[model samples]
Every structure is written in structure tokens, then in C-alpha cells.
Target: MWKYIKWGFRITVLIIVAAFLHYTLPQRDIVRITGTYNRLTEVGANSIFYASPDSGTTTNTVDRRDIRFIEAVYPDGGPMVYRNEDTGWIWPPYFKYDSSNLQAEATNAISPKDKPEWVAVTHYGWRLPIFSIYPNAVKIKAVAGPDVRLIPWVNIVVLVLLGLLVLMLWRMWAQFKERMIEPAMDDLNNTLDAVDARADAARDRARGFWGRLFGRK
Candidate 1:
């Protein structure tokens, strides 16, 4: 049962890390911007996915705030909406402070459906329609064509550094267990053995005295 519990905990941690990386790492979409606008959105269950109220760009309110939105269409005609918000001086560390500038760029990139102008949008996060949360666009640039490929150099470097950090932590833990915990456990086992030996000797001496007094041995 403990073995299963240990494996389950490791699996849960792995899943959480995978989800965090997927949400935080930048990705690119080849699409054409159709429009941009601002809306007073009500924040509720999905508030965790949005920028904090203290984020430099967002309003300081609890339930509702004005949010910038960019509407776009994928090369295949599928629709995608992106939230334009600053990451503030907080977690994930995008440190974006030019949301208005990004919105204007998105506005300038807008194209009609009949004469689509392809653009590469760099963004992070998941768009869950159920929660009305959209991926936040980080950067936008015009592309030559829909077939242009974008390499994720940032993700590769981040993952490699993370891997090295985890490896260093595991090695430190292993060294501590070997050098400190194992020797302490061995000394404790030796002390217990010495105590058991003394107890056995005392028991034998007690039996001898009783045996001699009773002339049983």
C-alpha cells in the first residue's frame, strides 16, 4: 500500500510539473488577426489563470476588470482568442509591460478573411472555453506565409537548465543519505545490539544464582 502511495505521489507531481511547463512555455500559432477590443470581463473560477490585480496593467478589483482581447483565425479557419495582459512582477516571469503596444500591433496586423495576412503569434496558456479563458499573446510579427516554422529556442534552454537543477538536487540528496543518514542508522543498530547482549548476560547471571540456590544445576 505504501509502495502504491509513493508511486501515486510521484505521478501526481510529474503531472503538475508537465502542466505548468505547458502553460508557461511560449508557443507559436500561424494566424491572421481579425480584430482587437476591450471588454469588462467578470473574473470568477478562472481568475487564477489571469493576471493578478496588482499586475501593472490590470485594474485593482476583485470580481470584474477590463481586459484586452485579440481575435484571430488560424490558417485552417479555426478561431482563436487571446487575452492581452501584463504578467506583472510575479510568477511565470514574462515581465510584460507593453500590453497597449501589443494591442496596437495586433490591431495593425488585422486582415480581412478574403485577403488574409499571415502573422506568427507567440503566446502561452490554454484556452478553455468552459471558463472563458484564452491564451495570452506575448508577441506578434508578420510572417511570409502560413507554412513558416518557428523554433522554440526558449523552451529548449529552459528545459535543459531545469533538468540540470533537478539532477544536482538529486545528487545532493543521495550524498546526504549516504554520508549522514546511513552512518547514523548503523550506529543506532550497534547500540541496540550492545544493549541486547548486556541484557542476555544479566539474564544468564540471574538464572545461575537462582539455580545454585535451588541446587537445580
Candidate 2:
């Protein structure tokens, strides 16, 4: 019974461990797809980098606010996206497109081709990311970056843990068999030996009584 109880406990622990690993192992994969796009630039130097949304005041709703900073500037007038070194969030500048400045070839003026129906800045040498944002939302469009592969690592770790659990279960069963079953078998053997000794004594007594009564010698 004690052996059974121990075996049950091991099985229960193993089951719990397996369940916990199964539930907690697979986490959401966060891939770092953006990085230092450009250095920090002055607020009004090239174009206005918009951090605040055009609509919907965040004051009463969530009370969330975003802080703006300068990252970098270009020697020539170019559309550049700057990201904070500490935080990976990209903050692009917001600019009013002027057709007259475009025709006059002004330094800060943005062209319509570069401003693809969005709050876009036209910089000749600058490249825009594949991601886009709307006026109401302050979402930054992201292009390709480091491909953080998560599924493979997750699978390998989980498989290794599962293998360990199986090995532990095997070892636990062996221990239970040795401690519980082997001891019980030894006790059974001892009881059988006592019964055999009693039977032999009874037969000897009966034989001696009969010989004495008959007086054969």
C-alpha cells in the first residue's frame, strides 16, 4: 500500500509538470523588425515629425501620451525616419505638402510622388518602410528587419523537457518496483516458511504417538 501511494504521488507530480509545461511553454513570438532607421533630427529643420495624432484627444480616454525628440538631419533635404535608440518606435515627421515649393525646387518642399496619399515626406535619398500610418492613428509602417525565429527554439526546448519527463517516469517506476513490490514478496516468502515448519512438526508428533501405542519394538 505504501508503495502504491508513492507510485501514485510520482505519477501525479509527473502529470502536473507535463500539464504546466504544455500550457506555459509556447509564448507569443515578438520579432524585432525595426531598428535605427536614421539619427535624431531637429523638430523644424527638415519636416515636422508628427508624434501627436491629428484626431482623438488621448487626455480623457486612456491618458496615454507620447514624447517626441530629435534624432538626425541630412546634408541635403531628404525624407528621413528617426527612431529612439532606447525604444524601437519609429517617429516620422509630418509635413504639409506644397506644390508651389515643389515647382520652385525648394529645399524643404515634398513632392506628390513621395507623398502617396499619406502624411509622407519626399526625400530623394531616403527610403520609406513598407508600413504606413493614418492621420488618426500614430502607427509606423515597418519594413524588413531581423527575422527572429521562435517556433524552432520553442519546439526544441519543449521536446527536450518532454524527453526528460519520460526518463524521470521510467526511473520512478523502477524505484517503486524495488521498494514496494520486492519488500512485499520477501514478507510473503517468510510467511510461507513458517507454515511449512508447523506442518512438519505436526506430522512427526502423529507418527511418534502411533508407534508408541502399537509397541512394535
Candidate 3:
């Protein structure tokens, strides 16, 4: 039971870590830009996903703000819309203050439905339409075709660094146990043993004196 519980806890932790990385890391989507426009969208309960007030371009007073939208379609004819917004100096740390430039590039890359020009959009975050949350596009570049493969170097490098960090922390903990904790415990045990020996010796001498005085064993 204990073994199963331990395994379950470990699996849960691994799942949580994987989910966090998936949400935080940048992903590339090979898409064909159909249109680019701005809409005055209301920021409400789902404001956490949107850009903050300090993003420099958007106003913070009103609930409605002009949100730049990039309408696109996937290779398999799936519609995917992305919102181009400044990420500011917080959160995911994109520090992206070039939403206008990215929007212009995306607009230039737009092609007709018959002759679709594939573009790679680098972005982070999820697009949940139900919650009115769209992925903020950090950058967009025109690609050769829709079939162009993108290797996720960011994810690879990040995972490698994280693995190294975990290994380093484990090594540090092991060294602490071996060098500091174990030696201190050994000293404590030795001192306890010496005290026990002295106590036994004192008791033996007292018993001998009492036995000799009373003429007992």
C-alpha cells in the first residue's frame, strides 16, 4: 500500500510539472494567415490570460481595449485565431513590446485561401474560446510551406537545464548528509555511549560500596 501510494504521488508530481512546462514554454504553429484586425474586447474574469495594464500600448481605464487579432488556419483546415498583445515585464517573461510590429508582419504574410502562405507563429499560452482567452503571438515569420518541421529547441534546452538542476540539488543534499549530518549524528552517538559507560561505572562503584558496608554480595 505504501509503495503504491509513493508511486501515485510521484506520478502526480510529474504530471503537474509537465503541465506547467507545457503552458509556460513557447510553441510554434505553422499556419496560413487569413486576416488581421483589432476588436474592442472586454476584459473581465478571464483577465489573467490577457495583457496587464502596464503593457504600454493598451489603456487601463476602460474595460474594453483594442485587441489585435490574427486569424489563421492550420494545414488540416482547422481555424486558429491568435491575439497579438504586449506581454509587458511580468508573467511568462516574453518582455514582448512589439505587438504592432508582429501584427504588421502577420498582415503582410496573409495569403488567399487558394494559395495559402505558411507562417510560423511563436507563442505561449492556451486559447480557450469558452473563457475568451487567446494565445498571445510573440513573433511570426513566413515559411516555405505548411509541411516545414519545427524543432522545439527551447523546450529541449529548458528540460536539460532543469534535469541538471535537479541532479545538482540531489548531489548537494547527499553531500550535506554525508559531510555534516552524518558526522554530527556519529559524534552524538559516541558522546551518548561515553555517558552511558560513565553512568554504568558510577552505579557499579556505588553498588560495590553499599554491598561491602552491608556485608552483602
Candidate 4:
């Protein structure tokens, strides 16, 4: 029926909107964070410390001195944090000098003003503190790490596929209504109308006789 077809189209549109939000919003940061700790008897001055507040209960802490800081923050908020205690390094959580224009959130718990203390000393990873704090240090002049960008051409491809799917569903639904449901409903409606007409006529023809029988009219 036309009613069913209209309902299906509405449902399809709702699904498309949901899918778009799922694919494009709240995107994850793609920059990778890494560093090297001392292989032998460790010196305290060489290790690095990093942290990420949004990483939930589980966070990453590494001992790499060259960890990318601005790359993680700018453009996308960030995935990781970097710190170098030995170098007296303190960087801004929002001040990204990288290609991505990520800055510290205005409402973030960790801000530039609340400079977090460094935890890991190069000499011993075992002495790391248990406090949750944002890193105040960053690697400067850092380029953006590789990210999977949304290409217009790829979008075109996706749109084409979505169009084809819509067209296919439309054709199939039209055929189903035409072949299976519409003719049956039409027949039922016509039969009901005829029955109604016959009942009206019968009532009209017998009404005067009944009235006169009841009251000498």
C-alpha cells in the first residue's frame, strides 16, 4: 500500500541520519605516542613521563623524551600526553604548535594554569606517582602525525552506494505493494461499499410499512 511505502521511506531516512553521526562525530585521535626507557642500570635524568586524562581509568605512561605533544592536542583534543621531568619541561595542554589546531578545553579539569607535577624520573620508572594530572610539557615544532582524512572522492563513492541502495529498496517495495497488497485492499473496499449501499436501500423501502404498522401513520 502507499501507506506502507511512505512509512518505509521515513524509516530509511532516520537510519541514514543515525549512521552519519556514528561515522563522523566524536572521532578518535590517531597520533601515536612512544618513548624509550633506559635499557640497563637506569639514570633518572633520561626518562620521560606522559598522561591522558580522557583515557578513562586506564591511562598511558611512557618514558620517551621525544613524544609528540602538540600533535595529540591540536585539531583533535588528543589521545596522549608528554612530559620530561629531567629537562624541567612544562608545556600547555591546549597550546598546540602542531598542524592540527587543537587547544585545551575551556572546561577541562587539567588546564595550563594548573600545571601538573611530573611523575617518571629517568632513573626509575618504579617511583612514578599515582596522582592523575595533565602533562605540562610538549615537543615543539612537531608536525602532525599521519591521519586518515575524509576525502571528498571517498564521500562521493559512499553517496553513490547509498543512492543505489535507496533506489533498490524503493523498486522492491513498489513491486511488492503493486503485486501483493493493493489489489486485495481495493477489492475489500469495493465489497464493503456495495454492502453498505444495499443495506441503505433495504432500510428505505421497508421504513414506511414498519412505521404505519406501529402507529397508524
Candidate 5:
């Protein structure tokens, strides 16, 4: 029962870590730009997913802001909309202040469905329409075609560093046990043995004194 419980906890932790990385890490989507436009959208509870307001930008009493949208389609002709916004010095750490430039690029890269021109959009977020959350586009570049391949080198390097960090922590713990904890325990055991020997000697001396006083062997 205890072993099963331990395994279940480990699996739960692994799942949580995987989900966090999936949301935080940058991903590439090979999409074809169909349009780019701005809309005055209301920012509500789901504003956490959106970028924060830029410095010196005023907000009305109502939660409304101008948000740029990038309309695109996947290779399989599926629609995907991304929000182009300035992630000004805050969460996700893109430090992207080039929403206008990205919008311009998106507009120039626009191609019709018949003459599809693929573009690789690098972004980091989830697009859950249920929560009105769209992935924030960080950068976009024109690609050769829809079948252009992208290797996730960033993820590979990050995973390697994470593995090394875990290994280093494990080694540090092992060294602490070997160099500090084991020696302390050994010293405690030796002190206990010395105490037992002294007690035994004292008892023997007392017995000898009592035997001589009582004229016994």
C-alpha cells in the first residue's frame, strides 16, 4: 500500500511538471497568415493569459483594450488565431515590445489559401477559447512551405540542464550523508560504548570492595 502510494505521488508530480513546461516553453507552429487586425476586446478574469498594459497607457473604467490578432491556418486547413501583444517586462519573460512590427510582418506574410505561404510562429502560451485565452505570438518568420521541419533545440538544452541540476542535488545529498551524517553517528556510537565500559569497570570495583569487606571470595 505504501509503495503504491509513493508511485502515485510521483506520477502526479511528473504530470504537473510536464503540464507546466508545456505551457511555459516556447513552441513553433507552421501556419499560413490569412489576415491581421486589431480589435477592442474586453479584458476580464482571463487577463492573466494576456499581456499587461504597456507603460503610460491609460485604461478606462471598463476592462477594454485594443488587442492585435493574427489569423492563420495550419497545414491541414485548420484555423488558429493568435493575439499579438507587447509582453512588457512581465510574466513569461519574452520582454517583447514589438507587437506593431510583428503585426506588420504578419500582414506582409499573408497569403491566400490557394497559394499557401507557410510561416513559423514562435510563441509560448495556450489558446483555450473557452477562457478567451489566445497564445501570444512572440515572433514569426516566413518558411519555405507547409512541410518545413523545426527542431526544438531550446527544449533539448533546457531538459539537459534540468537533468544536470537534479543529478547535482542528488550528489550533494550523498556527500552530506557520507561526510557529515555518518561520521556524527559513528562518534555517537563510540561515546556510548565508552560509557558502557566505564560503568562495567565501576561495578566490578564496587563488587571487589564489598567482597573484601564481607570476607567473601
Candidate 6:
């Protein structure tokens, strides 16, 4: 049924929006730094995410570039890898251009497995092994411990602003329909009624006009 299709579309849209926010919004992970290094990476032309192509760091090659990487491990001994790249002046608005500084901070935070020094890595992105994509780290700093609690203030504020923006747009659309669309529709109906009252020929002409205007059956 049309109703089922409409609901399915709505659910699909909601899921996409949720996934987008999850990937774009910054998240903090408490991990112990293990190593810092750079490797030559081949970038696909179809990549949805864009990096700054660091001025001096990246060399001219066909779909290939040098990428900085920071390796770390979680409290549970699980491995975590992050990519260091400039976001430039666009998209995500992190405006991060200090990959070197962050790398240095991460290097300072590195501690051995016996005396693990917990550091919170702030980043945004999904690590898809199939695509060889890693989360881009924006900030790195020492934390009290792996159990330290971190609040997502940025997400809360951003969500609130987005809700207000949607509400404002909905109100504007309602006003437009009430003030313009409804009045025009009423005039159309009145004209059609007048045509119907005049004669059969005129009624046929009006029906033809109506069908042409709205494609109504």
C-alpha cells in the first residue's frame, strides 16, 4: 500500500540522518598511544570524505598521497588507529590545520602497557576496514584515567540548534500554505463552480482546465 511505502521512506530518511550525525559529530575515546608514523596511501577518486592534501607533506602522484597515522590501544587491549589530516576551511568546520602539533601531543601522551597513560582522542569518522578509512583525530590530550567521564556538550548544543531551525522552517511553511496556497485553491474552486453553473459546455471546459492544471483524475 501507499501508506506502507510512505512509512518506509520516512524510516529510511531518519536512519540516514542518524548515521550522518554519528559519523560527523566529534567523539572522545580514551586510549593509550602506542606509535606515530606516516605511510604512503592510495586515495580513491570516489572517496566521499576529503582531506586537505597537506601542502608540503603530500606529493604529486596519481591517486596517491602520504598520510599521517597515530596508533593506539583501548583499555581492553583493542587496537585503534587514527588518521591525521587537515580539514581545511570547509566541511565539518573543525578548521583543524595542526596535525603536526596534535601528533606531538599524542607522542607525549604515549605510555608503556605496564603503566598505561590514558589520553582522550577527539575525532569524527567511521573506521571501515574494507575501505581502509580511519577516524580523523582532531585533538589529543592526557586524561585522568580510562574511566574518566566526558560530556558531549557540543552534540547537545548542535542538536538543540538544529531542532529550533527545523521548527522555524515548519512554521514558515505552514504560514505560506495558510496565507497563499489555501486562498488560491479557494478561488480556483469558486471559478470552477461558476463555470459549472453557467452551462454544460462551460462546465466541460472548466473540468478540462482543472485536469490540465492539477492532473487530477
RMSD (Cα, Å) for all candidates, in order, is 2.0, 18.9, 3.8, 16.2, 4.7, 7.8
TM-score, model 5 to reference: 0.77
1-217: candidate 4 lDDT, tens digit per residue: 9999999999999998766533332223233333222111222343223322222112233322222222123234334443322222232122323212222321122323133211111111121334422233322222233344423453467668888998999999999999889998999999999999999989987896798788874
Per-candidate clashes come to 0, 12, 0, 12, 0, 0
Q: After superposition, how far is residue 153 of candidate 5 from its true place, in Å?
A: 1.4
C-alpha lDDT of candidate 6 relative to the true structure: 0.87
Candidate 6 per-residue lDDT, tens place, 8-117, comes to: 99999999999999999999999999999888888885355647454334756867778789999999999999998888776778988798898888888778999889
Cα lDDT tens digits, model 1, 88-203, are 78886899988999999999999998888999999999999988989999899999989998888999999999999999999999999999999999999999999999999999
lDDT of 3 by residue, 127-166 (tens): 8989988988998988899889899998899999999999
Better of 1 and 6 by TM-score: 1
Scored by Cα lDDT, where does model 2 land?
Answer: 0.39
Model 2, poorest ten-residue lDDT window?
116-125
What lDDT would each prediction earn against the true structure? 0.92, 0.39, 0.90, 0.39, 0.88, 0.87
- Tell me the tens digit of each residue's lDDT in model 5 across 101-204: 99999999999888888999999889898998999889998889888889999989988999999999999999999999999999999999999999999999
Native-referenced Cα lDDT, model 1: 0.92
Compared to the true structure, candidate 2 yields what TM-score? 0.27
Question: Using TM-score as the measure, which candidate wins?
Answer: 1
TM-score of each: 0.91, 0.27, 0.79, 0.38, 0.77, 0.84
Candidate 2 segments exceeding 4 Å error:
1-155, 215-217
* Superposition error at 126 for model 6 (Å): 0.7
Candidate 2: Cα lDDT at 154: 48
> Which residue pairs come into collision in candidate 5?
none
**Candidate 4 TM-score, C-alpha based:** 0.38
Candidate 2 residues 19-137, lDDT tens each?
65543343322222111222222233222223333321122223233322112222233334432211113232223223222222222222233332122112211223443211111
In angstroms, give how far residue 118 of model 2 lies from its true place: 33
Best by lDDT: 1
Task: Give the residue spans of candidate 4 off by over 4 A.
Answer: 1-21, 24-71, 75-155, 211-217
Decide which is better by lDDT, 1 or 3. 1
